[model samples]
Target: MEATSSNFTLSTILKTEDPYSSLMLAVAALVAIFCYFWIQGKAKSKNGPPLPPGPWPLPIVGNLPFLNSDILHTQFQALTQKHGPLMKIHLGSKLAIVVSSPEMAREVLKTHDITFANHDLPEVGKINTYGGEDILWSPYGTHWRRLRKLCVMKMFTTPTLEASYSTRREETRQTVVYMSEMARDGSPVNLGEQIFLSIFNVVTRMMWGATVEGEERTSLGNELKTLISDISDIEGIQNYSDFFPMVKDDDEKAPLSLTHVKSLLMDMVLGDSIVEESHLPKLPYLQAVMKETLRLHPTLPLLVPHRNSETSVVAGYTVPKDSKIFINVWAIHRDPKHWDEPNEFKPERFLENSLDFNGGDFKYLPFGSGRRICAAINMAERLVLFNIASLLHSFDWKAPKGQKFEVEEKFGLVLKLKSPLVAIPVPRLSDPKLYTA
Candidate 1:
């Protein structure tokens, strides 16, 4: 009887242990399920303010599938219709806030400027711009400030730009002579090619103190053209990694690798070349031309993407921290509200009105606004204006046979003529003595 009682006690202990084990397993299962749902809820929360609106996105991919690789601007504009000017979009998992209206832009660029001073450089942009070392691509920080000071005080100051005027005048004279010869020969000149060469020569000389000549010049010019063309090409748009940081995919890493390769190439070609210090006067006409070109064809129509430093409200919408922001300078420049016949190519508009391209004025922001504006503005403006004025003063331009001057634009980092600015050139109708004098 005692043996039987002991056996019953052992059986009872085994039964009790089974229930405890089962209970632990059930608890673990419940916790796992809760975690899965909790993670999903956190992701959904990142979609931004619900009332502001945006395109519907797919799981993981987001709205990336619907984006047009060629013309991002068109897609952005379409979103504005459904979501209003302050619309949110998901490129992969990343959240971007597109600002299309002037009022909204003014709020972000002017009223709350300091809060939006940081720029986000994409992988592709980082590669072509010397790992964001170039003035145009640098982010907002101490490095950016130091670089800006260098460009302004040393590279593009009025005195430095003016010193290069004689070189510009000489190049202009050559352009006129070449065109005059072409006109005399009755040969059709590719005006686009001519203009590009003239600008290339002027910029190269000023930057490096060297003139390209012979086969080397031709090859170098072609290489520069290819680099610029590649930068503008839309085929390289989708960078999955930029938007989805948590997903460790190989495709996302490809752009970063490509950027490294480009940096190496740029360093080999244009890195060591530096500008020397010299006393000179500033050329006002040249400065004007550069500003005008940038106005018409900004390197990045939207400029560098800026992220909000803190959660803030803009245009009646709550923008969370780390949200990608884009400013549509293209639409702003063409806005009928700010400009007269905004589509017209009128450089004289500046002379006729008090409008300026500096970030101080919200109406014309080719270099961008606030602390994140391009550091190379001063230098770029001087280079562009000097080249444009020299070409125009030296040569009279005409369209090719039966080809009218159509101002159709092609989008890129820099806006270029869709068909290339090819034209016939004639020498400026001026006396030789006057030109020499």
Candidate 2:
């Protein structure tokens, strides 16, 4: 270019400016040349594995300005509708990929399971969990594995669940009795609060029941529940710092029918007694209902959000290192390809099928899949199934007058019904003494 352009002669530059101008010109020329080559290099990258296609991001904010945190999972599913199974999304300066298909889910969760195994800890997570060192947000390595191992040994095995059966049974029976009393008065019960309290007691007892006793346990339990509730709300909030971490600037369940309500209610509780843990396996229908419920409404729809520790290829696309990974269990669960009449509450799909809570079949992950799957799945299954069976067995539910039953969901740190359920329990058991027994 210097040889071809007569107007850009060295003599002209020397004649026009001060001596310092020549040096300035030289520096500018070098920068221009460097930029030309850099552009060429970036252009060449397009020929290689491309990033999963997604909505076009704005200059610096990326897609941060577009997201609505209140309805996050639904928003993600909508984005996937246009971007295909594997969708790339940019939040602030960070990159995130949403996996919406079971095939894509398998690629990230199974084929490259270890690659995207690290939890993408939020700002609150680090603060609450002491710099995210706890098992929930810890990286996939020896330390985290050790913590998980300890938890498994302490509270998350079949043997441990069996040992704690009495506590679960006791708590569950008390709930039935409470409902029965409510039934006698024809008082409406908030089943949500009831189930949560019962589960909370079961969890608290299993976690530290042996350590704390009497009033101290009660006090601690109450405090723990409040703190947990607060923590969940805090964790759900969208923080500006989290979106633009490099930029310092500021600103910015249940229940039964005559014998099978929703397929979830079963015959296990038909006798004059509360459902027992021993009866769980004997009742395949109860298990199917559990599976169906989870499929329709996953506890954590996005599965706690994974992050790739290293650059990886997922579904033939370049998923860069440090990319936040979201396995959209909600969408995948309702995929028409895998499930027939996916929207319907059909438990029979799981009856003859071999799918279990182990996360083997990627198509139905109620408790998630891969190494980061819920550590206490055994305990959870045992607790939930037994409680649900017992509830359905003990009484029949009747929604208050003029209140329509709805399944609308409101996602948060956990998924919940948009409107809390208010239903009255009508005793279904043959013997009235069984309510207290």
Candidate 3:
């Protein structure tokens, strides 16, 4: 009976030959071949210092769904509780390393500074900044060096800032006048918007020298404001293509798409520009306020993702070549280990400590560290300090009726107040001349 059954099976296999069955066998054989190589590769990688520990990822999307959009920095900080300070997380196909402690930050920003100086520019950043000509996303090379030198020598030097101090004061005085009128009328003002306008005007005047007050200035300011807002929105959006570069979008490749945004400066020589830096000993408190604000809410919370040029070990863990690096300054700033009361808004902390945002101290690198630090640090400092001081010194502020003061931040390319600050400004200055536009 066993011999008869074997003969019948052999005869059936010889008699039946379907095209579908042949194709199925072929596909099965290919799959088996692929699996063999895949398993072999996995076995080989096991011998190396494995990629930093991270939560289990799904098939394709990775750990993106786990991130909270409203507060991405806080979500990342929460992850550190499970996976140590230097942990790995996948955003789509991309590998990302989150550095949350001062030690890890020092390694990436100071020790291995040259290795991680290259930026991982987003599609929007490349499109908006004229093919990455601007200093923000430019690669580390001779061109970048030239741009940095020009910025330091021509624009942000102490003499240049000092030359333009009068322009800042003039704009601040105008803002005071406008706020005083609003105070007299008992109307609530959008404090954040007002502050933005003041800073924008000061920076523009410093860059473009003098301009007549008319529809031209208003039109230019409004246009620049809209462009800036749009750029910010594009920058902060979670575009999957940024992580998975194989994906393409029509708009990103389109011509005449935000190619020449007039306000973005790299090494463009503007002969008429005038801002000369000077000693600011009297404004020590003003500087502290800006520093405190930055610590609480860095403009770029994840400090412009960096790219490792070669395979490197960071914090005793193997960081593969071309891995994305996110130095979570936001998380580091709020660490209880480094700060006394991490959540509090105490500007006095800066006054007590000698920590400056010049990238010297890893514990508080709001601007960043080493060679790729922000090129416009001096100008940014002056603009922020002047704006804050002018507003605070000119008026006493209170929340609008029926509104309570709250500190909330929204995730974006630049940190912004979740709720635009709406407050009533009460003029404190006695001299009527001080309020003139």
Clashing residue pairs found in predicted model 1: 162-281, 162-282, 191-423, 192-422, 286-385, 286-386, 290-385, 299-413
Give all candidate RMSDs, comma-separated. Answer: 13.5, 8.5, 10.9
RMSD of 2: 8.5
Off by over 4 Å in 1: 1-51, 129-131, 190-193, 214-219, 232-236, 248-299, 344-352, 430-437
Sorted by TM-score, highest first, which candidate order results?
Answer: 2, 3, 1
* Tens-digit per-residue lDDT, 68-121, candidate 1: 645676568667857777887877667788887777788998887878877766
* Ranking of all predicted structures according to lDDT, beginning with the best and ending with the worst: 2, 3, 1
List, residue by residue over 164-219, the lDDT tens digit for candidate 2. 88888888887787788779899987776666667788887887784333344335
**Among these predicted structures, which one has the highest TM-score?**
2
Residue-wise lDDT of candidate 3 within 1-437, one digit each (tens)?
A: 99978677645644568877667767987787667645643653465666677676543566887877778788878898789899888787777888899989999988898999888777777777898887877888899899989988898898887788888778766667777877888998876666667777777677776543444444555566668877887866766687787895822221111112112221122212221223244545556666777888788898888988987877767777778888888999999999998877676677898998688889898888988898788878777655655566566777677886565777876777666667798866566666677
Predictions in order: lDDT: 0.62, 0.78, 0.73
Each candidate structure's TM-score, on Cα atoms with residue i matched to residue i, is 0.70, 0.82, 0.80
RMSD versus native structure for model 1: 13.5
